[model samples]
Target: MSLALEFVSTVRADRSGPVDTLADVDGLTSWARAHAAGPGFTASEEARQETVRLRQAVRALFARAVAPEPPSRADLPDLPPFKEALALVNATALAAPTAPQLSWDDKPVLVIAPAAETDEPTRLRARLATAAVEFLAGPEVALLRTCPAPRCVLYFVKEHPRQEWCSTACGNRARAARHYREHKK
Candidate 1:
């Protein structure tokens, strides 16, 4: 999965309701470190706000990419216009000066390197936005599906021809609900 998919999954569906894992600075900091966007990145309140906005933008784009299929209910409230979301994500990805640069160990490796002057938060945002842009442009976006299982608000790439729900747990839940409905009547 792309970091973008994982990032978008942060706004999750709970039994009670939608939950935002990045609702606070500490959460954002932990997420950043976990994603290796920056190992020691400490998110400021400003960075938290910016990151959330970027997430919204990415979610909006993902919603558009999976057109005609409803998007994650969790993201519905914050989604901006498709054009606006596209602009925001592209802008964020362009904020840092990054280029394909060569790095060599035993074998030569090509890497996209952002400028040394860019701060951690900015670089983190750029990396995430770039990944989202790439995901949206790539063929995998066509396989994106919003989980149809009741109370599920996640998206997943359809890995198999028979795949429907986001996970086996969701599939089981959906089947159980269907069985209950059928027998109750």
Candidate 2:
């Protein structure tokens, strides 16, 4: 499978870790180019800047998903358009317990937006934040998780039933640390 596919797959999986808001955008565009899925998406420097703006949005969504006190709609910024989009989506999700369906595959697919095309930083932030909330409401949104590795902020799904850390590197490091402690005794 392509890196984009892997990125999507990982996002849709179950695990606890910090969400990798934009790490896979370049890889995804690369894979999209290789697979001939139209021209590769070249995220402009503006997009990169937008991604930075989206960090707070994504983080806020994660906070809503895992944190106790989530921001209220009233607490949202004064930006009009993105906030409106967020309200629309958020209200829809709130009204419907089930996630919005996207693909027609055998398995249920929940639609979520990527931060790549957001033109306005404020709007992008709103979309990502809204998307995160929408994702959190879904039955399949176990996608939002924290890395089990002690200090690692990277997030990924728990592919295996017993998987924990976002990557095997973190898992190995943890295991090695355990071994060192035992052997030193």
lDDT (CA) for every model shown? 0.89, 0.45
RMSD of 1: 1.4
> What clash pairs does model 2 have?
14-158, 16-145, 16-146, 16-147, 17-145, 17-146, 17-147
Tens-digit lDDT track of model 1 for 1-185: 77989999988877888888899999999998998475778999999999999999999988887879888888687698988999999999888868889899999999978765788999999889989989988999999999989888888999999999899999999999999999995
- Tens digit of lDDT per residue, candidate 2, span 105-164? 898777844433433333333443445564556654454455545545443445777886
Top candidate by TM-score: 1
TM-scores of all candidate predictions against the true structure: 0.94, 0.44
Q: Which stretches in model 1 have alpha-carbon errors above 4 Å?
A: none
User: How high a TM-score does candidate 2 get?
Assistant: 0.44
Worst 10 residues of 2 by lDDT: 4-13
- Per model, how many backbone clashes are there? 0, 7
